[model samples]
Target chain A: MIAAPRKLPAPWVLRTFVVLILLLVWEIAGRHGSQLLFSPLSKVLTSGLQIFAEAEVLEALKTTAWILVVGFVLSVAIGLVLGLTVSMSRFTYQTFLPVLLLLYAIPQITVLPLFVLYFGSGPASKVAFGVSHGMFPIAVSVIAGVQGIKPLLVTSAISMGASRWQIFRRITLPYLTPSLFTGMRLASTATLLGVLLAELYVSAGGIGHLTRRFGENFQPDKLYALIAALSLMAILINETMRMLERRYSRWL
Target chain B: MSGASSAGQALTLRLSKSQKRLSLLVKIGVLVALLAIWHLVTVDEFVSPFFLPKPDEVLRVFFNIIVTGQAWPDLKVTLFEFALAGPIAVIAGGAVGFLISLTRYGTRAFEPIVSSVYAIPIIIFYPVSVMALGIGPESKIAHGALFGFFPMCLSTIQGFSRVDPLYIRLAHSTGASKSQLFWRIMLPAAAPTILTGVRLGLMLSFLAIIGGETIASLEGIGHRIVWYAEGMQTGNMFAYIVFVIMVAVLMNTALSFLEIRRGRQ
Candidate 1:
């Protein structure tokens, strides 16, 4: 029971070693394996630049980015409004909360086809899908944050003669910031998934179309490169949001 | 001023149980009203049938699909993919996690790599999968398994690594064999976290399978929705969408229940 604590090893050094070995193995396998089975890292890197030079790929990436930004902005605005409205009044909360939760619990991916049908396989569909996915997390989290405020604080503020508006501004809003940021981080990821899924489903324009083209043409190298680029974009967005969450959550 | 004060006091009175019941009723009422409005608008052509089919029409289509057995093959494909992917994810994740948890050094070396990768949305690799595996169920299964793998592995590692050393020490002192110690102590200690991982893995696999079908499948529930939508049969499309959502909800609920039940023991 009183066993001494185990000495922790150097994590980064071991990680680097493992990664290097894996990469080397992959490089070797790519050289020996069938072209269809694998593309060497060097070939992929060289052809990757060429794939990026394609105008359609560039345009598709821009369109995806635009949709992500616009949809996220709209989701945050709408989520904040709906979350606040529901949290403000017990009547509204009880009357609408269940419905909101039911909708949120539904697997939204199932409706991708319907979204495309209604929005005509355009940017509208992608943006709408993104907004739908992104809004729920923010709404749920914001409601939780608002409802979780310490009761004593509210009472004390009122006792001190703070106006309703002042109480909301000085207390509730600030209290909810950490949760709001956490929700936004989650929402951003969901939004990205929704928009990307919709875009991929449409397969008529944007990144999805390019991927489809590459897949059909058996351009594995190009496909891998393109996907890697998109993944990096997703990682960047996620990391940035996580940083913001960490920064704001410090107060808690 | 006295009357206003009295009114304020009266309004601040605690809610009765009946009021709580009434609020539930109101919530249901709002939902029903929303559906009613939907029905009315669609029936009246205020919204185009193509955009939003009537609820009755969707129900009729649902019945027809069920009666005609149109959904069976797609259901089989999706379920098969899910079945294959789910178990693969569990076993692979368990193995990797077990290996990582064997020593503090392994945990230090691999845990961060696994977790950081897990933090990113992994579905972005679907295109590469589709490219490698083609547009069939193979791609879907691969995509689903990959999506499910990260969470399962991470959770399993966390579970095993956090097992109390006190139990291990006691077992060792009691002349417990390695296999017996593992079965009695390690397995029981790690079961809850592993179960959580399995639940998450199953859910993600299901979602990824559906997403794969939507993206590029010749058949499956998702494909059926897209087919109906493209054919301007909005009613059937909506029905299929509802059916799929229901199935997902049921799957998630069942898994959660199972997890809770297991956790108690």
Candidate 2:
């Protein structure tokens, strides 16, 4: 006799259930726990909604968003150019790859204060920090992508009388797309971390200041709301990058 | 084909010796050039000394801090917090990951959820931690533990769940007991991936502790860097920054060595 098919909830349904249960626990804990330390989900939700109406918070968010975009774009451009240049010849790749890895290994937070000193406590410093954090992953990934291109493919293209430009555009570009996406996805997270770290470190005004204020003033609701918003933004950016990576990686 | 490949490999190996020397020379050349440029700009006053202190000054101050033991207290605080957070993250994350991987449905349902949460900048919750745990080592430990947890958990899940079922089946067929099966088959199979996760977790924990200190704490090496920066003592700040980088490099090097050795075993 054949066994009956097992019925199970979908992952999303289970996820929703998990979320609801968590919210319930949070609500109960917040109400019963220290009011000064924790805010209930209801209060946090209300405050989260209210923050959008605050002009100061909105302005700070816009500043952060603008800087994040600029930093990300700059990192991608620099990383791609540098990656291409170094990977052009095996000699250059051998000479420079270790340097890049060494620099990458250096815990960048140490130099963050130096960034602020040079760039000042402004968006410039944030962007610089973000670029520093984001670019290495891209450069490394790009190098790997290039190195992984089978020599046989290049030889065949050469035999077929494909010019350097055509060979690159046809064979290399498509092959590198997935790796580039992977790098970008990692870079996005790193960029966010760098920018946020800079922001949190010494912001005269912006989300950093607001976070400090909320924490110091015992405004747990507002603090939770602001964090939830930032977390949401991070989730959206990461998910978008992942989706793009998946799409491009399908060819592999 | 084998002969041709081996010959090619030998040729490449011979070429690599000279290539390695050339790379080292280039690396040294680059470092010297950067230092020269740094000295030139600062000495010529092309860049403000306040902004970019001379390499000599930074080096002098770095030695001063070490000699005077100015960094010891802050270093202790940072290390103490790391000590507490790193182990907690590894154990808790590993345990949870193992539990989740026990059932295929659990793995499918929860993996995405955990990863999605992981993608969120958990640093945004720093303020909440600061508020709840106060502006002390407790907050830093909590923050570091939270930051390290996701990687540890994800890697553990990936490691255990992906273990070859054939090995487990063979063990069972050989009359291996449950604990014996786990100890002899599953643990060895999953060791490398789990060790990698542990390495990542520990590194991130240390970094997060420093980051937390930079953000809000009154003590720790990160706070000292900020303190000097705010005071506009660029020389001392640069010194602390250099010291912190050295510590990080050392820690990461040690962890990588451990990972390699254990992975081989």
Candidate 3:
């Protein structure tokens, strides 16, 4: 297995080459293939740029963004508080964790209608849905973070006359940071999913309406461009979370 | 020292038993409280029945739908899509993942791309599937299979890539045939992780199928809910939601049971 001596292109170069080829194929297929289903890359890109310049699409995007931000921030805040309180004592943890797991396990999509029914088709429903999706991972991870701290460290701190606050501040906080970041990364994706699902389900206004309009009207170029823009936004948010996770993971 | 430790262990065990009982009591209490609150909110029109149907009404509608067999067609469609998608995802993903794991360079080149793609919410591609496959079960199946593929591929790559080299070396020295070496040593070694991937893939495929139907399907369980909601049949909609949740929970439980049983073996 080790006998062969060979040289190969670097991984990044290979990846770039593969991507370029795929793009080329897509462009060709769009031009030559069925006009009803496919849009050329150039057309999609230009449409994407043009749509961003439109006030209507911009408003929709802004609404979506607002819901995502609000929901995620609320999730982090609520999740931290809940996780900390639950993990504060064995009784609370035992009593509450199964409930959280039960709620989490429910296929939340089933309740999309209910959410819209209660909160209407506006931002309120989307934000609520996003928080419901995002908060669980954070709370579970935070509990795990607290639980994972070595008892020996706490004992040693106690022997050195550290107060409870001091022990928690020094040991627990640092230990939790890495896992907390990991939770945030997971939460970011979940929140986006929840918000987007709500948006799409409503089909009244915002990104969902735009997509449906584009799809039904047979505007493949506009449809592809809109999806691409949303995907780019998702990637940027996900990458930021991933970077934060990596930065904090050094502690673990 | 042994006697003292044994006594301590017994005490702790007794304490744990009491704790378990207490936790169960608390759980039951919490559920009851939630149901009570829900009832209270609807009792005197504190909340609109149009928005939140009473528990009794929802239960009646649920039973009515089940008894009338209104749910059968949608249920069948959903299950059919899941069955088709699940196998497609497993075979395609497993084959590709196995091939990738055969070379370190292949694993290095593809694993990151696969994972990053997985991170993006794949629902964005639903419209594309609709465009290509139309607003039918085919699109839902395709979407589900695509969604399920990533986890299966990633886990399979991870499972095979991390197998102990020493075990392979030992098999080779024993002059085992290639097929025997793979089937006996590699397959069993990788089975647990691969099984986990399978479970995840099937679950995600099921969820994706339902989600796809919700997004743009003519008929299915998800579509039924949307239809009811648009018609403002809140009671019936609630009933459908409850039914779907039950199905999901049962599927999740059954998968977990299989995973645990196999893990024990």
Q: Clashes in each model (backbone N, CA, C under 3 Å)?
A: 0, 0, 0
Top lDDT model = 2
Instruction: List the candidates' TM-scores in order.
Output: 0.90, 0.94, 0.92
Tens digits of per-residue lDDT for model 2, B101-126:
76677788788877888887777788
lDDT measured at residue A141 in model 2 versus the true structure, 0 to 100: 76
Model 2 DockQ reads 0.48
Tens digit of per-residue lDDT, candidate 2, span A1-252 = 012237877767887898899999999998888889888999889765697799998998888889889999999999999888877777787678778888889999888888887898878999999999899878877877877777789999999999999988999889888888989998999988898888888757667667878888998888888888888888899999999999998978
List A-chain TM-scores for all predictions. Answer: 0.92, 0.94, 0.93
Any runs in candidate 2 off by more than 4 Å, and if so which?
Answer: A1-5, B1-20, B44-46
The true-versus-predicted C-alpha distance at residue B65 of model 1, in Å, is 3.2
Identify the leading candidate in terms of TM-score.
Answer: 2
Name the Cα RMSD for model 2.
3.9
> Could you arrange the candidates by TM-score from highest to lowest?
2, 3, 1
Per-residue CA lDDT of model 1 for A1-252, tens digit only, reads: 123255744678879999889878877887887777477777778885587888888888899889989999999998999888877866666666677888888888888877777687789999999999999889877877877677789999999999989989999899889888888988998898888788777776777667667766777678768776776776677788889988997987
TM-score of chain B of 2: 0.92
DockQ, each predicted model: 0.47, 0.48, 0.42
Q: How well does candidate 1 score on lDDT at residue A67?
A: 90
The digit string of per-residue lDDT tens for model 1 on B120-159 reads 6676677778777878999999999999999899989999
Model 2 interface CAPRI class: acceptable
Error of 3 at A249 (Å): 2.1
Assess candidate 1 and give its lDDT: 0.83
Superposed on all Cα atoms, the candidates' RMSDs to the truth, in angstroms, are: 5.8, 3.9, 4.5
